[model samples]
Target: MQTWLVQHQKLLSQQLAQGRLAHAILLAGVAGAGKLSLANWLVQVVLCRQVQKNNDQGILSPCNSCKACRLYHQGSYPDFLSVTSDSKNIGVDDIRRISAFVETTAHLGKNKIVLLPMAEKMTTAAANALLKTLEEPGLSCVLILVSDDLDMLLPTITSRCRLYDIRPLSGQALLESLNRGQTQENLFANVSQLPELTDEQVHEQFRQFTARLLDFIIKRQNRGALLALLNENTYAFRWLEYMLVTMARSQYNWLSWSALRVKLVTAEGKSAATGAAPGDAIGQLPDSETIWQIYQLVVGCIKQLKSMVQVNAAYLSEKLLVDIETRLDK
Candidate 1:
């Protein structure tokens, strides 16, 4: 387990020790924050048949040698249901299946666990159907919902569950945690010259890079700066996608800074309010429609980077930057 998860684990284990575990748990956090891992760990603790006593702390722990634990580790646990959708949205049928699974008895005489990853992808009908199950889940059933964007979920669904917000660790902490059992390679090269950078420093760098890119696009200036950033790191495409999304939200005054985990910093080194519209420096910023079009283009470029066929990073970046500039010009 990572250092960030240790604290959460201790809290959750205490809840279990006190017999205060909720029937439904909602793990909310940004992508790569280990919500799913934490959920999995919690489920394992619940499903483990034998409880081993910790000699040091005098606490109970999951015994991995038990039949239940072995089955779960092998991915053949009959009482465990992991629901995920390959389609763009999870439909009512998915929820119905989960409901049926919950209605059945637990095979191991332990708790039945249902894990729903990307719960926000559920459609309205699906969410409504799941609400019924959440309201009346049996005594031995546990439902875990993981979502990267909690705002996208229905309030009714979230209101009934015990919510746990997971946050990412800072640079030195994250590095130390990740490096516990592995060798360290290049991790902070793109963000700074130092070997490590705090989370705030990384976000600040991202904000500045994004602001400069938008300025170039809005002014119809050369994209040499943007290209230079892209050339420095392959992850720049992903950063560009995030910047475009932020800009879209800013233009429509729908920016959720806390949810997005980004602090918009202006070139003047001032923190910009999420509700404020962007500056009118190139006349008006592109309208929402144009922004969406540019955003989609950036998304496509990002997808191309992951294709099995090799893509020319410089060429793609230049094309995407010019296309965005042309759209803003219109």
Candidate 2:
């Protein structure tokens, strides 16, 4: 586990020990920020019998060999449940089923836990149905909802859950953690060892790398080296594909921030009623309009590619690059 995440775990475990832990918890963070890992750690802490004896601070982890921990690892814990989405949305039926499960007594007389990943993907009807369960949770029942997008979840849902924002690991830290190898050889430079490739083969691989790189930039950078890459005609299609993937990743991570931003705006509006300026409510956050524009432009290009339309990839790539450049200028 990362350092920051470990700190969060310690704080949460303390709250649990004091019986002050909220019935619902929202783990908000970027895609690779280990939100799910922390959630799993929490489940162990909540389910571990030895955790109680140690005052919420055991030897770095739950005694994995214990009967409770063993059952959890094997996925045989009757009181523990997980709900995941299908398609783009988690349907009302899924929420109802989990809700029904929570209403029942725990088989081991332990806390009944419901872990919902991508909680923001729940449809309005589904969210509203789950709201009833949140509004009146069962005794010793806990709900842990993890989402990259908090905006899609109902305001009622947000209010019910105690939200914890998980910040992304710094780039330097992430790279260090990956620690691929100390050797100076570039991962992509060795072509002879790779299978013989034709012109079309090279183009496809170039396209894949371009897509991954674009996704990385959009999520992490405002305006930087990518502008130069966009100006060149060479490998333009691959670049555009990378931008599309990046945009998709951006949209995925924007969910929670969007929800939190809206909440701030609402609170700001209320503050304005008391003679304070509303501008103070929003503060100085990144321009969401630019984010949406980049997302839509990439999405438009993706749709165009899907239809096999007579479009010039270079022209589209340059156009979107200009749009991003303009947005960052402000």
Candidate 3:
């Protein structure tokens, strides 16, 4: 168990002891809050015929000896259903399958568990389809919704579920806890950049790229070195978007994770104009607005790359770097 989540686990245990655990549970938090882990623990406890108690927090865990536990651990549990998406959106068809699953009886003659990780990824149609299930979650069934950003989810979807807002430790508290000798793997396990940082080589590549980007932004250095690195790495645009996001948050004294996530969704799109405003500092680091503007520009470049249109990626990359330089100098 993550030490930061020990308190949350205790609260959950208290709720379970009082027999007040909601069937439709929504564990909402930012990316690194470990809400998905909590959802997993709850599902294990629900499926276990015999639950074991933790002496520390008095939290309940599954008895791995049980038949249900064995099946679940083996990924062969018939009563358990998870709706996942490889793409950006979870479509209506996925939600319809969930409805079909909820209409059935539990194979274990106990609780049927359904988990929807990143539930906010559900499309408009998917969210609407899920409303029917949320309104009438069948007998002896538990539906768990794990979301990184609650703002992306529809109000109607959230209203039907019991919400537990699990927050991540930030700033000093985060540093203190993580410094207690946590390994790199454990630290990055729940980060949004996991897919990009696959190996040591890739990790070092990003580390250097981040350093160069800071030099370009804060030190007002030439863009030649940065542009070279950007053109080399196919994922450079995403790295810039991610770094600018962090810098933007730090610019605001490390803004709240939830609040930053909201800004990420609501920030303005790419603009036609690219230069800095009149009277803007010639060589100083940009303000918050400029940081977000550059973020949107990078996102635009990424989108263009994803499209079917014939694009000169190297030209696009150079154009973005040039635009950033132009924006830095009024």
Please report the candidate that would top TM-score against the real structure.
3
lDDT of 1 by residue, 1-330 (tens): 655666777778888778898889999976657788799888888888776656554435679988988988899989999999976678899999999999888888778899999998888889999999888834578899999778878999999999998877655555565553232212232222222233455445555566566557555554787688876753466677766776678776785433232234344534332223443223345678998999899888877754423357778888888788777777
| Candidate 2 residue-wise lDDT, 210-264, digit = tens | 4333333334342234544544433444445443443344456743433333322
lDDT of 3 by residue, 44-153 (tens): 98788888886776888888989999999999989999889876678899999988997887777887899999897787789999987777834677899998778778
Q: In model 3, which residue pairs have backbone atoms overlapping below 3 Å? A: none
Weakest 10 consecutive residues, lDDT, candidate 3?
265-274
RMSD (CA, angstroms), candidate 3: 10.6
Worst 10 residues of 2 by lDDT: 189-198
TM-score ranking of the models: 3, 1, 2
lDDT by candidate, in order shown: 0.71, 0.62, 0.73
Model 2, residue pairs in steric clash: 149-255, 149-256, 150-255, 150-256, 211-242, 215-246
Q: How does model 3 fare in lDDT?
A: 0.73
Any runs in candidate 2 off by more than 4 Å, and if so which?
52-60, 171-296, 299-330
Best model per lDDT:
3
lDDT of 1 at 18: 84
Q: What is the lDDT of candidate 2?
A: 0.62
Clashing pairs in 1: none
- Summed over model 3, clashes come to 0
TM-score of each: 0.60, 0.57, 0.66
